[model samples]
Target: MKRQQLALFIGLSLSALSATTLSTTALASQASDPQTVFSQAYQSYLAAVKADENVQQTAKLAYTSGKAVYGKSDDNTANLAINYAKAIKGYGDELNEQRFALYNEAHTILAANHGKQSIETIDALLGQANYTTSAYKAANFLEQVIDIAKTQNKPKFVADMKLEAASLLAKKFSSKKYREAKNYLEEADEYYQENLPENSLERIKADFLMASFAEGRKKYNQAIERLNRIVNVFDSNLNFDHSAELSAHSKLIGLYEKQGKSEEATKHCLAIAKMVPWKESQEQTPLYRVNPDYPLNKAKQGRSGSVAMEFEVDTAGFVKNVSILNSDGGVSFEKSAIKAVEQWRYAPKFEKGQPVSATSQVRLDFKINR
Candidate 1:
């Protein structure tokens, strides 16, 4: 998982617990020293475990202790319940039915304290989605999150959730689900355009997702357009090593091959080949390279592609004037091709033993089998 996903997961878990609490006089008195309450609950839970008491009984004691701090309507109660549930889940390698039961109990408590459609409830849903055994169930939970985000006027959040939901739906592509996934991607693109900066990573990601969605729908031209937009941004920004850029390039190559644009595809393949380190001078070689992730829709359908590009290696060994010479695929391939070439480094050509700029080309191929 990416760092962003992990952060979002943690945030959602905390938000779910925090937002569900309802204030009451009893809660206020207990909340005066929440730390003490949490500590007592932990100690009791540890003691119960040490004594080898009934696991469910010990879990209940922990839950009760947490509730004493802020009543049943407190975030601390949810947090304690979640912790105990995790402990139970990790207690043994065998399937622990009690763990899910406890998780459901915590979720029910949160929903009862808050409203079913509340952000708190959505958070719990996200947690369930993360831990659930069923992909369909997870997709449904993400859809709910998207709906809640829409109602709250959180366009960025809506886009984020929609992207996640679309990805899930795309993974399980059927005639119906593919259409649904495309719709989600389209909606996410709208939100991204309205709420995010043109060069924002989130917007780039949206474009990547849109390209995939377009390809899945056989809207090759639209997919190309979306990918081209991503490449243009990377070219202007010069942050060519982004994973999205690589994906764009790879998809473009595949799309081109599908269209029988062999010449264009060959160019992209050459452009990728140029990315190999020119080790004539160690200092001139690329320090790092980021490969694009294969398009999920394409992977599912057993598709492949390639891209080619040209650029100038400056005296400083930095790539410059990057351009797609040809691409068999659409904008997706071109974007990634240009992006990678733009980051290429090489020993500057020598004329009379003096460093000088030189022109070069490379190709990249995207393939997968499953």
Candidate 2:
């Protein structure tokens, strides 16, 4: 199996275990020593995790004690701020200004203490990347890390940074951005071939990004070739990421559909049905949606309404038996919703490693252009 790699994202989460921790108890007794208090706080946090209890209290204690012990402007203090931020972020306060400030604090301290080019600044820059929603900005942070890794003669780190930089830049399409990202990816590919194993997930992820780049540029043939390679790899190496394989099939469907190749698209549609569905997050959700059309009569009358329908996605991943449970609109709206849903597709549920039909409920809304 390919070694698990860090998540390739702007907010590449720093490991919370970076700081030392061990047996410690009674925070009140360790109040005199901020370091001891910090350790105690982490110990309490571990118990909370094991017991599946809320971690806010212990997390706050760790933050408070960490501040006291890491008052100096140095790498240790920078890392402390990052860990504290990660703790609260786990509670779902991802967009809070305070969290971003904590990340910025780490970046500032790291730059001041170790200089901009030091390897130590990498985490802080990556931490700051989480504070921004812009893919371009996140790629910029990776670019800085690229320079730092080069300065420190860390080829592996540089390659890792480039891989992520390419992924982020692939989020949008622009001729200039594509060219720049391609360069980063090409070099990273070279490093991966020489260093990482043949089946490295990171290398596969890099290929995925390159495929996305091709898709963005409307280079459909190139994108299909790359995605097919990923699918083939997973076929031989069952340990590979199945989601990426499903995603490859999904991408192939879109690419083929754009070229009016229904047979090719259905091949993927059937492929998805044979595989288990991904539901842990929307990131892995496949889109074969066929939107309901607005009725012309409703549009001319400036009427808007919704239709609630229940349907089954058969083992073949085709929508069937779309029954309207309710509707605020007229029969026209109901008919449109049914027609559209019948064309929709899904990754049918699997049981005992076998494809199974599944039912779904949906509310399709239709609004006239205002």
Candidate 3:
């Protein structure tokens, strides 16, 4: 019995030792070393950040310094240094140095791994662009990046990147660089046709930008077509609740007027007129505040009375042929009233879908508040 008990104790001891050894080895294999953990985490972070350039770069630094002594194996340390520094900079963190170094490394690595002709260099170039301060500098960077990406047949990235480039180009259009900006926008359109959904907002936006650019060049027809798509094709309901819709309507109205479509212009003008609320009043002649352009004697106090005038409103909504049916008193005041009346615009009466000359009477009253 004594021998058997001793043998059992020895067996238990050996089993415990073996179990402890296996546990240590397994832990070591998994993430036993802090260095190994850091290395793995760094690589994971790099891959995770492929699309987000703005990710907190401290992720790399944390991984570099997070390793415990046991994890600080030479192989793990070297690999950690390589990959982390490859995505980041080894030198003390100057924002420019860190940015430029990462870009340089990204370009070099992409060229080596993805082939010299790959557009992956665009990724690096874009990173460099993120650090640029000047609009022109940023545009220049994005242009090159987009060119390379498109050359390497990356349709989606090229398309996405072109949005920023096009905006910059539009801002710089007044300068000699407008053509280059236009070319960048054209390239963006090509990408949108391939990658974006038909009738997508992005595609619509691209069309809108091009249209505005055309309009800036006084290409009215092209601008009208683009504006029409936003109203007719994209937003068929003509919802005017938002500022964008209002702006679109305004553009369409201007285009109509420019193209001599007076009828259409009148329709829009009436729509705008309807938005302004009218106050019901019992006064025969409502008090009219003179527009600053009206030549009124500053020293003279306003005299109150009504002057009834007959006017002809033309097809273009212009008031013409003003004649006073009844005058209150002064000739100077009457003349001033008639002159301002001639320049007044009216909502022309419509007959058979055309604005016709209509006779109307307006009573003008001048009142000044003390």
Candidate 3 runs further than 4 Å off: 1-136, 147-153, 191-198, 237-241, 270-370
Tens digits of lDDT, candidate 3, 1-370: 0111000000111111122111101112244455456445544454445554622464465334543431333323322333344355334447556655545555565566656555545555555555444556666677676666577565665675676567555654436557766887787778787777645556666777778888888898898777766655435544323344445556767666666675666555554334333233321121112232223563264555456788786655566788989866456557778877765445445555555566777777655566
Judge candidate 2 at residue 4 and give its lDDT.
Answer: 17
Q: Give each model a TM-score.
A: 0.50, 0.75, 0.42
lDDT of 2 by residue, 91-110 (tens): 33444556667778878887
Model 3: lDDT of residue 291: 32
Candidate 1: stretches off by over 4 Å: 1-9, 12-74, 80-106, 130-136, 172-176, 270-370
Candidate closer to the true structure by TM-score (higher is better), 1 or 3: 1
- Give the 10-residue window scoring lowest on summed lDDT in candidate 2: 1-10
In model 2, where do residues sit more than 4 Å from their true spots? Answer: 1-36, 46-57, 90-96, 133-140, 169-183, 190-198, 277-287, 309-315, 320-326, 348-362, 368-370
State the lDDT of candidate 1 residue by residue for 1-370, as single tens digits.
1111000112431211133321211222233455456445555555665565665456666576656754665555665566566545344324344555555666777678776677766656655655555666666777777877778876677777777667656655444467767787788778778777788766776777777767877988888888878867876876456555555655666676567664554444433334333445333333233466555665566767787767787664557898777666456656755665564444455555455677777677877754
* Top TM-score hit: 2
Model 1, residue 289: C-alpha shift (Å)? 21
* lDDT over C-alpha atoms for residue 123 of model 2: 69
lDDT of each: 0.60, 0.69, 0.54
Question: How many clashing residue pairs, candidate 1?
Answer: 25
Q: Can you give the lDDT of residue 132 in candidate 3?
A: 44
